[model samples]
Target: MSAEKIQIFDTTLRDGEQVPGCKLNKKQKLEIAAKLDDLGVDVIEAGFPISSPGDFDAVNAISKLVKNATVCGLTRANKKDIEAAARALEYAVKPRIHTGIGTSDSHIIHKFNSNKEAIIERAVEAVAYAKSFVDDVEFYAEDAGRTDNAYLAKVCEEVIKAGATVLNIPDTTGYCLPYEYGNKIKYLKDNVPGIENVIISCHNHNDLGLATANAVAGAINGARQIECTINGIGERAGNTALEEIVMVFKQHKELNLYTDIDTRMLTELSQFTSETMGMIVQPNKAIVGSNAFAHSSGIHQDGVIKNRETYEIIDPAEVGVNESSIILTARSGRSALAYRLKNIGFEVTKNELDVLYEQFLEVADAKKEVVKEDLERLMYQFNQTVETKFA
Candidate 1:
């Protein structure tokens, strides 16, 4: 069966840059946008054109540079914001105006100081206003994770009727459990009238570390578009990591879902995002971390050395890394020691290895790690011991 395609709507320039010190200049934003287009994302959320002059310029510049992917500018449910977004995206071959308002009661009461009816009216109006500028409009329910499903569905139905091409249900606060988020998307698909006419998108956050899981759940339950950022950089705990969701679909074929992302560019793009934004990706990040393909445990090293599939579900090369690794430390076992030795041009007999293992432990105990030079010195000393014993 042909796999269903999942549209990757990358919001790195829009949401990921929200990190306090991670702002990129217009030139930097354009550079990243060009790469994101090459990486095969379906849509690039360039920036909120109404936010600042720099943002407006960056969005406009990116709209001109990005060819294959749709260039999008964000806006609030206001006329001025929508107009600014339209003006910023005038150069885009495929321009999209993403505009919406909060739907959850908390946002309605505490944030907007508005009621559900007023919020719904604003949402429909926003979609219609955005549609006047561009043929493709994505309507995001700001904090839909906690919004009432029935009301959310009604809002979605109204927007679809008002000419929304994509309906974004964002876990704005990163608060929903995977099942809860999935059920929310499913509810819209099952309950909303004329929902099948528009693409259902999932925008998740990682405050609870469930953004990727919730996004995948949404996809499994029927969301065709995933809104994510590189390295998951955003407000608070950040939005979903783009690499995580793309790798999830690539690794789990049982779901029968796929994306147009160039898997090999994942690591390079991840690093580029971190570097350009002045943000650091965690060492243990899912797909593009330093340790994603590194193995230190003896058992894991042995398994990986035997066959990468034994310990790694995804190959390092698949994400643009050169190769897998076996880190040597005091915790390493004979198998890892042997593997490292062979790589450095030393092939010892089983009997020789038995003797070497004891001496290696003594050296390992004296240091945190063992390098190839350390191994060579140990082997030289072992040869001397063997010769002396024979004499």
Candidate 2:
């Protein structure tokens, strides 16, 4: 069977910019949007046009710049917000108006100060309003993770009937377990009338560190779209990492799912996004982190030196990385040392390596890492000692 293509809806410029100190100007947003189009995302949520004049201009400019992917603008379940999003996306070849309301009881009561019936009415109105502006209208049920399954299904059904092209089930607070989020999608697939006519999208956050897992779970259960951001930058904890979800599907072929993303651009785009937003990706972050494919431990280094598969599930080059790094730390073993030495033009027998290992440890202990200069210095001293002893 052919692998099903999952829609990658990227909200980097919108949700990601919500992070403190991570805002992007119009030029920066356009640069990222063009790259996102090249990266093959299905949708780019540019910004909430009604929020600020800067955001409005950025979204409008991006709408004209993007070619392949749909340019989307976010809004609340109100006519004013929907109108602003529509105006901003006027020039997009493929434009989407994303507007929705909170469906969960907590959000309805505490956030909106409204009841389920009123919330449903507002959601339906928003979808209908957005549909008038564009053929593609995405209705997000914010906090759907905490919303009762049955009630959530009702809202989805109503919006779909009102011409919603996609249903966005967001774990607004990043508060759902994988199984729970999966089951929620499954429930809607089974219960929501006309659900098959519209796409089901998973918009997850990483407050509890389960955003990627939950997104995968949602896909396995029936969601056809995954809404994520570059480097997982967002409010609070973060959104699901785009690189993580794309790689998960790539690595797990048994799931029979795939995306159109250019995997080789993952590292480059990650670095660009990080630099543009001033957000540093954690060194241990999956896929695009600095140390993701670097091995320093003796045992692991030996395993990787023998074969990359023994230690890495994903090939470094597959994600645009040049090669695996054999980081020389105190924990690195002889095999790792030998590998580094050979790369720097030194060849040694096991006995010679044993002698060098002692010196290598002394230097490694003095510093966090051993660099090429340090290795050259070590070899020079060893050669000098040997010459003096022989003399």
Candidate 3:
């Protein structure tokens, strides 16, 4: 069977900018949007047009700039928000109006001060109104992860009947477990009428750090689109990391799922986004982190030196990195030391290496890492000592 193509709905500019101190100006948003298009994202959620004048302008500009991906603008389940989103996306070749309301009892009762029946009516009306402006209308059932499965199915059915082309089931609070989120999507697929006709999207957050797991689970169950942001930057804990989801599918071939993202651009884009947003990518972050392919432990370094697969599930080059780094730390072994030595133009016998290993450890213990200069100095001293003994 052919692999299923999972649509990558990147909300880097829209949702990611919500992080404090991570806001991007119009030029920055456009730069990222163009890169996102080149990276082969299916949808680029530009911004929430109704939020502010500056946001509206950015979304409008992005609509004109993007060539291939769908330029999307966010809105609430109200006419004014929907109108603003529609106006901002006027120049987009493929535009999407994403509008929806909160569906969970907590949101309905506390946030909206409304009831389920009334919320469903608002959701259906929003979808119908958005459909009038564009053929692609995505209806988000905000906080759907905590919403009762049966009531959630009802809302999805109503919105689909009202001309929604896509149904966005968001774990807005990032509270659902993987199995729970997967079961929720499966429930909708089984229960909601006309669900098969509309695309199912998973918009997950990372509060509990299960956003990627939940997204993958949702896809395995039935969802076709995964809504994520670059570096997982967003409100509170953040949204799912786009790189994480893409690599998840790539590495898990048995899932038979794939995305159009050029994996090689992941590291480059990640750095660009990090720099533009002023949000640093953590060194230990998956896929694009500095330490992702670096091996420091004695056992791990020896294994990687023999064969990359023994220590790394992903090739550094596959994600645009040059190669795996055998980081020379206090824990690095002889194999790792020899590998670094050969790269820097040095070949020593076993006895010579044994002698050097003692010196290397003394230096490693004094510093966090052993750099080329350090090794060169150590080798010079060893050669001097050899010459003195021979003399």
Candidate 4:
């Protein structure tokens, strides 16, 4: 109804840590949580406390330490899990309980062998029970992407009536496309009673490589919260990346959806999560990847050198990345070589470029990447005459 403001719900500690070999200790979790606070997240899904004693301690520590962001603990539709989450969140300045159960037919047949009426009952009870312990309750419908839209609307209505501050609809398996996920959120907005008062959250996985796209689409429709992780590291291909979603919102000004995220800390935060979680971010990954702004090909390098807008939509510095690179290789043309040299105060004529072009080929044969220093060393070695005035 009003201008949309996308809330950032970071699930790095919960789902991101679920990645194989990504276990973080209490201290490590606290370190990450503290950084998440500085990075300006709206809510931090601290951990699933009932999963393990270590998780319980980590969640509790995060609840105590995280002062600005809402510290949240996850629970299943059971008393033990809900109680553990409540206990872990006792120390939080603003605490929240995130509890849910599967609602899709496949999950019902395989995971629970349950019926729709029973799932709705559990969903309502979970939200109510969670609300009893804490004022802030977020109810999730697991596998919601595949759940019946009408039933999903009904479930969301009941949960909002039960005092859910946020409703999370997760494409848990990364199966839903952009159109479907946006419709899911729009369905809830149009059908679910009292939905306008609560935040609509989208949790997407990247198995199909549409996580961030789905998230941005959700925001564009009406969903006001995104459940994301740094570096997009999570169970499978990871959730929507916090950095990617924020940058997308920034780059697309027409969307007009804003988050509390500190834009500058994105790079450092991405590096921390990737290293701490033992997951190496792919170079081609959007936003936080090493090559998100890198240009190696000759034509692309020339365009970027002439005007960043030729190839780049957003400035590299917007996401804390240093600059676009012009990598020198056999594929790189003489224009790129002279452009890079000119930036370093070397003046070279067109004819001189022809002379260095052959030398660059020889240099490329030996070096994997031709750095500026490498070019300098090559110049020193050749001491040859320039066809024109080449650097």
Q: lDDT by residue for model 4 over 18-68, one digit each (tens)? A: 989999988889999999999899999999999999999999999889989
How well does candidate 2 match the true structure in TM-score terms? Answer: 0.99
Native RMSD of candidate 4 (Å)? 2.5
Runs of candidate 4 exceeding 4 Å displacement: 1-3, 343-345, 384-391
TM-score of each: 0.97, 0.99, 0.99, 0.95
Candidate 3 deviant stretches above 4 angstroms: none
- Residue 176 local lDDT, model 4: 90
- Model 3 clash count equals 0
Model 1 spans with C-alpha error above 4 angstroms: 384-391
In candidate 4, which residue pairs clash? 348-389, 349-389, 351-388, 352-388
Per-residue alpha-carbon lDDT of candidate 3 for residues 134-176, written as tens digits (9 for 90 to 100): 9999999999999999999999999999999999999999999
Cα lDDT of model 2 by residue, 1-391, tens digit:
8899999999999999999999899999999999999999999999999999999999999999999999999999999999999999999999999999888889899998989999999999889988999999999999999999999999999999999999999999999999999999999999998998989999999999999999999999999999999999898999999999999999999999999999999999999999999999999999999999999999999999999999999998889999999999999999999999999999999999999999999999999999999999999999999999999
lDDT of each: 0.93, 0.95, 0.95, 0.88
Q: For all the candidates, what are their Cα RMSDs to the real structure?
A: 1.4, 0.8, 0.7, 2.5
Model 2, which residues run further than 4 Å from truth?
none
Q: Write the per-residue lDDT of candidate 1 for residues 1-391, one digit (tens) a residue.
A: 7799999999998888888999888888888999999999999999999999999999999988888999999999999999999999999999999999999999999999999999989998989999999999999998999999999999999999999999999999999999999999999999999999889999999999999999999999999999999988999999888999999999999999999999999999989888888888899988898999999888898889989999999989999999998888878888889988999989988888888998998998898788889999998998898899999
- The worst-scoring run of ten residues by lDDT in candidate 1 lies at 325-334
Q: Model 4 misses residue 187 by how many Å?
A: 1.1
